[model samples]
Target: MSKPSKSNLKYKICSLLSLFFMLFFLFPSFIHADTSLQGYKEVFQDSPIIPFLNKKESSKENNKEQYQRLEDVKVVPGGQSIGVQLETKGVLVVGHHQVKVSEGAKSPGEAAKINVGDTIVEINGQKINHMTDIKPIVDNSGKENKKLQIKLKRGDKMIETSLQPIFDKKEKAYKIGLYIRDTAAGIGTMTFYDPKSGRYGALGHVISDMDTKKPIDIKQGSIIHSSVTAIEKGDNGLPGEKQASFQTQEKRIGNITKNTDYGIFGILEKEVNHEKYEEAFPVALSHEVKEGPAKILTVVDGEKIEEFDIEIISSVPQKSASTKGMVIQITDPRLLELTGGIVQGMSGSPIIQNGKIIGAVTHVFVNDPTSGYGVHIEWMLEDAGIIKPESNQNAA
Candidate 1:
């Protein structure tokens, strides 16, 4: 080949440099979207609910000042295994199946333009609070040959539509052709418990429906005792998991009052004993978190809470609330050997550094099982109502 022109070579170098810079800035966000957090599997069960949170915000300056004043707030770090059961405020529309009727098979819900992830809050002017509440109204409407007016909550918008129930010849019951669920149950470690407020935070992330992938709009929920029975070690491209069972007979330790982007928050009915740290301690703000050695409290065997060493590979002082505020890697040989790094059901395991709780493990890197994401403790506290509750509310 002939020698290339200097101008052509310069242009090629510039293009290559631009590509490198673009990938450098874009790679982390891409990884964030792929990082998987453990603990959002739906289990059929009964659960409780949470109250509406005030999401009004003050000015940014006021917000900073308010957070500064919250430095003295103390919380008991939680690492005990717990079972979470959440019931949706109204029955959720997860999917639609064909209803076999005398006329033929059809889906009334799909025909009505009721999409999956919609929450049916009312039917025929009657409020729908449970799956049981829907059947009676549907049956009556079908018998009366009347179209039912349905009110649904889709995201932040409330809309209405008409849906006619079809009579099934085989079962002789009216059907809407929508598969719905009211409750979701799973296992996770608790992040913190504020004794003074009886409020606790856990999971370090939202509980989304497995099918719809939307946050569960809880009517009520409960957190019961749980035990870690087994672990599936993590590996490249495959995240590990903590296999656990709920202590059903044991009284619920707390009631789930809120499910937000940060985590689940609720009022504790009783103290969660068996935590590694018995006494309440201060929490480091996002700005206070640093890149250094840290400890994480979690359960690898049974109900026993144990501390494992980890390192804060990087920490960011966030001006806005975010779930991935810190990058962490498991440094303890025992933890690495036993679990192969962060696993499912360990999302809310508390991360302590320099005697202060700084954050909780939230997600695991799919490509590197040894490293994961940590959310700043301040955001969890805010979600738990232990600190500034009026601002930055993204509750599910």
Candidate 2:
């Protein structure tokens, strides 16, 4: 204590300075009171973590309004692709699949007649799905990499094929290019367009390979009719899954557009007429979006159409597929109380603002159902490759 070290002296000086700074910073609050909201804003932004705090705070203030919009969802005209999904009552998805090879074994995939992304439904008069279901097959097939026969369903097309596995020297195991999915998870919209251009897709965002969780190849997919049998709500901690039946009737519309974060798209075989519906209006531009209020046109509880109020949070300056901007809040207690905010099947619901169709609800926040993502109507129109791009300000 008689002789303090240099490091110790520096530490004490720093500590005293820190105390002085703290007192100095706090003195202001003593002079001028800080509001509660101000404290929250400071605490939120000043914190090292909580990156999205500002966004959340902004949303909390912007999305509450009554009588905003719930106008009508109308389909755009001139879309002509007959792309449709085969309806199914249920589908099983899994990974790392094995199948049988017919009488005279055909080449691997041909023997199984399986496409790269086809969901394997059954094998050898057996409904092969989960790992436990094929434990016996794996044990039996382990004996030898011999040819085998199997039956498979590729969307609407069902076929039989032969398969043979090859042993990999590095891994010392038999390998087949077969992958499977045990459960089909996603929201699929039906379309009336089917094109022979060897082009069609569903779930605008590609279906993931259950095993690797990668996008599956769509060029090999066949359209199936999946009828909605049950729908689960998309909410916090649990993203709702949509289930449907695979039916044979090949009813569909439009060429498939690329899968987007906003959901899937296809050329419309039949336009959903926003104009024909009650209170139909012209679609609005992103620049025209007003933050006060709006309504979304959607089908809830099988009613085919319903209206609800929501506030527009923000809008973009340029056109984009995801352009319609707004952090909408459901003002209708009936909608909020009955279904949370946005539901799964509500993906394509149209949002009308100021007598113009502007956006479609795309996704629901898993944690907050009432809050979700919406795609600008212009993006859908552009994806169709039909709607002409608007002229820029210079042209105007």
Candidate 3:
């Protein structure tokens, strides 16, 4: 019942302090339990919690970025013949002729300075979508003796002109002496098709008028199955062409939605069969294309889609979009002997290299039928709107 000595008390206090220090070092989590609430098992400056949270946030951002990427994109390589029918936005002036009037032979369109290749979009504030749409306006304006206010699209410019319709004695109707066409049709090859979306692209170049050489402004059109009837051999100075006959109504393929510099795009109503390349294939970026041997899927004769050998003479690693990205030459003796190299209607033939679709044949050299220019598939895919293009990036 007596008080302890100071030395013993000091020793006991020292032992108590030693025990507290040991326990704190051994079980720091139990001593500092508040650390758990802050998402940390250990109370340290470089705790793994911060790294884990940062990693999780980075992973979420990466997932979102990958969702919009084109790494999973695959397309079916097209090689069959397609008959394209393009209806213009309005009646296109193909030529100007003299109208035989009672007074004299004169051309109202020529007098108004309305050149050929101009698309007449409106007449007297009435929209003209077809060649037939002009007759009523012409007749009414002529009977009233009113000057026709013509609005047209020439290239990217919209122009307005006034033309006075003349009474044609030969045709017994009012005439502007402008030969206009509302529709154009031709045969070309298919480039690629996204099987998942049923969207397709074809004719690696724009469809232009033979006389005016201006890109056709498409309003609405369609494509149908076509059979190659014959092939004209190409020469150094002359380009060959494929003569194909469009199939019947049952062969209606798809409707043309857009006609761009990269070619034509549409949603296919039915799948286009590729006899050899039946499966979807991946496409290469422009920088990935290498100069070497390659193969092209195209029809040489009849309805048969065949593979032909070709050489990639050169390929450009483009930082921006371009229509011509590579130089190609026909090396297949069979193809050379058959079509005399890259001919017309073979513009959209899929160019494959190293098991990847690199591009499509765009144009044949006028001086060298054996060699031609090919466009990178990325540009065509971007124009087709299959993949979203990044700003200043070569491809999506």
Candidate 4:
């Protein structure tokens, strides 16, 4: 072919450069869209995005089913006081101790890079469930003069390390210089239970380690029947508490399987009895809860669960799981006089509105004892895996 014109060659070069720049900028958006699609597949399986993108009719149908399912949920409101004992999945390192060795004061665990929040799951290839499990292995390793192998979990990562135990001359034992804990015990109100499935949710919040202030990784746990012994009435600037006790040998009421930011969840071993709340009530989604009069089921006297009036000062319609979904105030004269509003042990007391379960008492206002924060019951059920909203199919 004849030689091309210089202007035509320049036009071809300019066109190619323009296309390259366009794709470079658009590539990031394409990757972002693909990543979001994958996340939706994992988190929003029932709410199909592809159908909604292709057909407007499909989006309307999916939205209707979600609302219908929320209206159909039935839950047994729980107000009974319970004692919780949680065992960690592994031996949790709460603090580090200084060991008095022949050389001087030092912490072997610190030297091994074991932090305060690290959970020791395995030592020398043996699984560790309790503090006792670690003592034997440490003692033998020190006596035999062998380096101990430790496998621990820190956050979402598993870590392994080897360290020689320090022989504490003063204590006459092998010391890793770690203060570890295996179990945690506390009292809380039962929020709700599903009579059909025997599943229960409680605490309305996560159980954090006293020292580490991080959520404990649950291995297993149990809830026991407890009786209110006394009430430390609250006031401005000081939150009150409910003193309760349960026999150590008392039979467990439930088994805890998961601990999340929302609360603790488990399967109840037996049916809970509440004279006033014998019937199961429909649960309301966060959007359905309104700012108005409501009632709370809680134990203020002995073991008796009584209903007390409260007002939902404000309702927050959350689209995701959150701890505080509403602001509540005690309106009942009896409850206001008895506990001075919500107390520590009443963390999971069921809040009922319009004869339906709306949420649970979570945190008491330090400045205003009459008012505190509440979490929607819907989030609690979702965290417990009792109600799978994403798995609900559209009504045919």
TM-score of each: 0.79, 0.48, 0.81, 0.80
Worst 10-residue stretch by lDDT in candidate 2? Answer: 191-200
Q: What residue pairs clash in candidate 4, if any at all?
A: none
C-alpha positional error of residue 51 in candidate 4 after TM-score superposition, expressed in Å: 41
Q: What's the lDDT of the predicted structure labeled candidate 1?
A: 0.85
TM-score sort, best first: 3, 4, 1, 2
Pairs in clash, predicted candidate 3: none
Q: What is the lDDT of residue 164 in candidate 4?
A: 90
User: How far is 355's C-alpha from truth in model 4 (Å)?
Assistant: 0.9
Residues 246-270, model 3: lDDT tens digits:
9544687887888887889977776
Residues 210-303 of candidate 2 have per-residue lDDT tens digits of 4555444332223333345555656676766444455433543233334444335543332232222533245555566667788776544422
Against the correct fold, how does model 1 do in TM-score?
A: 0.79
Give one digit per residue, the lDDT tens place, for model 4 in 205-249.
Answer: 999999999999999989999999999999999999999998753
Error of 2 at 234 (Å): 4.6
lDDT (CA) per prediction: 0.85, 0.48, 0.85, 0.85
What C-alpha lDDT, on a 0 to 100 scale, does residue 181 get in candidate 3? 96
lDDT of 1 by residue, 46-139 (tens): 1122111112322332224323246478889999989989889998999999999767799999999999999999987888888889888888
Model 1 misplaced stretches (Cα beyond 4 Å): 1-68, 101-104, 389-396
Task: Write down the worst ten-residue block by lDDT for model 1.
Answer: 38-47
